[model samples]
Target: MRKKGFTLIELIISMAIIAILAAILVPNISSYIKKANNEKAKDIAAIVFSNSMRSYMKDGKFQREDVLNNINEDLNIKDNEVDVASLYDSEITVDFKVSKLEYEVKIDGEQSRYDFKQK
Candidate 1:
């Protein structure tokens, strides 16, 4: 009588199927994870924008260093992962980069850019 259990060939076939599925799914999952990370970085940049607006309301001025410092303090933005540049109303352009995503929030609502690159 045959044992009521998987045969060696059956076990090997199941493992092969699992490996093939993994090989097909891994790259798609990886791509999705990278997209999610990029979106999270953009969310942080939006937080920076809100903080800048709040600071402007309070101080009647917008300064790059001050806003960046507030983000570091109030929002606990990681210093090593983010950098700020020329992000004030008085400035012609606002540039803030978090992780690999760069955003330019323009006062005139024109000439803004959001792009990803290795940093």
Candidate 2:
């Protein structure tokens, strides 16, 4: 009678193929996941910076470092100084500064300033 199931050699070949595919795909998948996480970090940083800056303006503490506590804890941001004068004025052209490698965010404007450094 002919065999109905795969032979041992056939099974081994199939497993080998699966392993090869996994080897190639796993790194790519990991890299994509890392990139996604980094993007999420950036978004969180932006929100934190903007909120802190707004709070500073509203509280009349534009030059004070006391604005850091306004951000939520989940963002994992640390205290850092934001130089509003250097960042704003008529010379200022951008609202934010982001560094993916350093995981830093800076918000620049006339009313307030904020610095976020990831930990």
Candidate 3:
């Protein structure tokens, strides 16, 4: 009588297929997760910057360090910067650039940039 269970060749083939599928999917899933995290980080950073800027305006002064500090405090980030340069951290480095009302943020090594203007 023929065996009811999978043969060695069939098992090997199934495993090979699974491995191929994982190889194809793992990288795409990883990239999507990284992109999602970066998006969330950027959104939080933007909100922090906006609120800090409003506070600075209301108080009739502008101090990048103070604003950054306050924003960090509010956001529970230990180290943050508001310079028109790179802000490095353990997992990512965020670069900030502002010219007049235009502002840009480059997160990590991604080419995608977030830009905004202050009114």
Give TM-scores for every candidate, taking all chains together and pairing residue i with residue i. Answer: 0.62, 0.59, 0.55
Number of the predicted model whose lDDT against the real structure is largest: 1
lDDT of the structure predicted as candidate 2: 0.53
Candidate 2 structure quality by residue, lDDT tens digits, 1-119: 88698999999999999999999999999898878877776676666566555655674433333434445333445444222232432112112233434455555545344455554
- After TM-score superposition, what is the CA distance of residue 73 in candidate 1 from its true location, in Å? 3.0
lDDT score, candidate 2, position 29: 100
lDDT of each: 0.61, 0.53, 0.51
Candidate 1, lDDT over the whole model: 0.61
In the predicted model 2, the residue pairs found to clash are none
TM-score of 2: 0.59
Model 3: lDDT equals 0.51
The full ranking of all candidates by lDDT, starting with the best, is: 1, 2, 3
Where is model 1 more than 4 Å wrong at Cα?
Answer: 1-8, 87-89, 92-119
Question: Which ranges in model 3 have alpha carbons more than 4 Å from their true place?
Answer: 1-6, 80-119
TM-score of 3: 0.55
